[model samples]
Target: MPLRVLSTLDAAKTQYYHFKAIIVAGMGIFTDAYDLFCIPPITRMLGHIYYKSNNSRIQPAAEAAMLVVALLGTVIGQLVFGWLGDHVGRRRVYGFSLMLMIAGSIGCGFSMGTTQARVLASLGFFRFLLGLGIGGDYPLSATIMSEFANKKKRGAFIAAVFSMQGIGILASSIVTMVVCRIFGRKDHSTNDADIAWRLILMLGVVPTALTYYWRMMMPETARYTALVELNVLQAARDMGRVLDVPLSQIAEVDLVPPSPPSYPLFSRKFFFLHGRDLLACSALWFLIDIVFYSSNLCQSHIFDIKDDGSAFDAAFKVAQFQAKVACYFTIPGYFAAVFLIDRVGRLRIQVVGFVLMAGLYFFCTYLYIKDSRGVPFVMYGMAFFFANCGPNTTTFIVPAELFPARFRSTCHGIAGAAGKLGAMIGAAGFFLISKGGDDPNRDEKKTGIEVILITLGGICVAGTAVTMLLTRETMGISLEDNEKEYEGESVQGKCFP
Candidate 1:
């Protein structure tokens, strides 16, 4: 059988809109990382301000909720917005997610009440809403960017969008450092600390709000137009404008309209075709996030390996240290993935990342058990570096690439939702496990931390195995062809090839 001709989107040369889409979509991811991560440094600060006693740290349950609540919201948001992106249009529902984020961020900043319980509840509620917006961005941005990008550079483009996450992490640290420096020098009052946390949370609004207009202006993806909407002419025109190519160029191609699946997304037939792929995407993401969020949310505290000076000073020092590591090491890993994803291929990168992360975790565990200080810190940083350059990046990129366009956002949402579920467990479980640190039992606390580290290593090993068994390499394949090959039918007609 002859190969089916590619559509305008797949065949189009790389152009300006690709980069434009990257920035527009990338900023959303940037906001996500910033909002999600900025909380860790301030968790203690909130305790100081609201509880008004240095000894009164956030309760283990409340702290876990604070860390994981947004994840719950993200899971819901990903499902709702992902389906909306498919059923309505990607452009139509895109900006609303940011709007939700803006509101949630501001609400978090203003979170206040007569008692600590009220304040914690208020903050958690708003962060959950923010998570919803962040969740929506996952599927919408990945799907839109994937559809807009040419096959030749799709992996790099998608990974490039995700790399913004590294920048967001850096920004979270820098902003925290600057805020602490400004506030820490003057008055160490609870009120001052309160103001500082609010400032940090509210700062998330700037980048998200700035991108809203550009996000609204982005045209619907050509593939969504052609295949999902069955409007070949409009898809061609949209592609022509975005790619800066003549309509004649797009017009010359023989376009095939995608066949409406005979089965619904929940049908056995659909499951048979995509169930393995969905499981691969979801489970791999789940395993990756378990390690990713655990390290990320707890790093500042982990680096506080020794009992230090004043509580305020100690917290400030930890934030600054974490920020510097993120700036110097973590951010670089993201760009490395962006550079190597297309060149080295997604599966190889993910496999390498998981294996290296596991090895690094084991190394860190050994160092922790032996009371080796500086080296463990270095290994932890290296683990973070590999996480970004490996599974963290590929898990995101692969789901967008492997799914059928008709349900692309929905599938991506499911995978993203699975990841957030893992994040919730990692955040909440780590909080519970590490509660041993506060106990009079020093050995127990040490054992708890070591166990967490070893467990993360095991999770990474499991991730590597799942990737090996379940997923297919998607390097250099056009999105349409990838879907058609998987579905085993022509795009337009139902006839099996």
Candidate 2:
């Protein structure tokens, strides 16, 4: 029998807590974006302070280590924290990730060393810690939001949570610009701008720290308490407090589960039931991140703004350009996903995004092959728009909803880990391609960039095929219905109007 509390949660009107939940959960994402995207500028600052090179670019080896370490930590964090979320409870494990983020941010900012190698090692260590926290947030935040949201607007709520990413990126750029402007010296070679990078790195803690208290205060998701733990009374009480509803309405809920799964996670029965969905979510996420992170991480190099002034000035300009792109394309695409995800359906949106992204990648490839010197900001921006509105948002949302509450976080983490692995690949590949210098017109550099774009395009085509063939639409459907389908039971009715 379906629990009455679950029904009420799925049918509850938009409440104050819903918005509060979004803020608390969304801030984690905001911090995640800020920390991840803020690196380009910091690397520039590092090159200036430590590398002692005329061009002020860090060595290829140090740059790759710094860039890819967090990704590695994130992958491990996702798997570890994801399993913890299911085993220990979401609320129980959620605060720890935030704490790690706070520590990591501060540690990164305070990295101490007399030598360049030691400083790089210190920074890389802290960043890996930061990535762990950020990775944990992905599965926990998405799963919590999905469980709390009413079925009717679940897509919008989840998308809204992910949309904070755009805001975080904008914040990173703005903060970097402001810091560089204030601390930057007229002389391009001075160490005056050293503090600017530290400040930018540490400032990510504010949003993360702000949300930590509220994150702890959040009740364990009702689905986890009731469905996973089989504690209907606690679930009812938690939701009662959250939704501000009377306990009497849900305390009397039916306790019988209509054939809940008895299999362990990743067992044969579990795989048989959810294997295809897992494959789709993981594969699609992996594919999208390759395109997303590579382009995002290498934005400065791709734009190849001529060194018109001081190194500090160049850093500020890069920040401004990033902010402009975020404002024009990234932010809009995220909000568009928020508004249209439910209306258009996740499957169609993802498929369309992949197709469009493929076309744009091919076009960009052509432009690069033609040795176009001008920034293809229009094509690049359009790609960002579709990506945010399409796979990036949907990849996070679908994994949360498709699996049972028992394994939801674990599955989401696995998918997220897959995505991060792709990110590591993309970041590594593009950084290598651009490692030569800032000159986009360099013959060898142009060829490498064109090859990467073409590869991304081909991946998108594969993503489209995988998405269409394997994914399911969870729109306008209750979480319980997903469980019912897994149980091989006939769904009696839709829970949402």
Residues 357-452, candidate 1, lDDT per residue (tens digit)? Answer: 999998888888898342366778889889989999999998898777788999999999999999988988887887814555767767778889
TM-score of each: 0.93, 0.95
Which residue pairs show backbone clashes in model 2?
Answer: none
Score residue 307 of candidate 1 by CA lDDT. Answer: 30
Best model per lDDT: 2
User: Which residue pairs in candidate 1 collide?
Assistant: 257-492
Q: Once model 1 is optimally superposed onto the true structure by TM-score, how far is the C-alpha of residue 113 displaced, in angstroms?
A: 1.0
Alpha-carbon RMSD, candidate 1: 3.5
lDDT of all the models against the reference?
0.81, 0.86
| Consecutive 10-residue window with the lowest summed lDDT within model 1 | 488-497
- Judged by TM-score, which candidate is best? 2
Q: Model 2: per-residue lDDT, tens digit, 235-315?
A: 888888879678898775446643455778899878787888899889999999998998887777777755455557767
Off by over 4 Å in 1: 1-6, 54-56, 252-258, 305-315, 372-375, 485-497
In model 2, state the lDDT of residue 393. Answer: 96
User: Model 2: how far is 211 from its true place, Å?
Assistant: 1.9
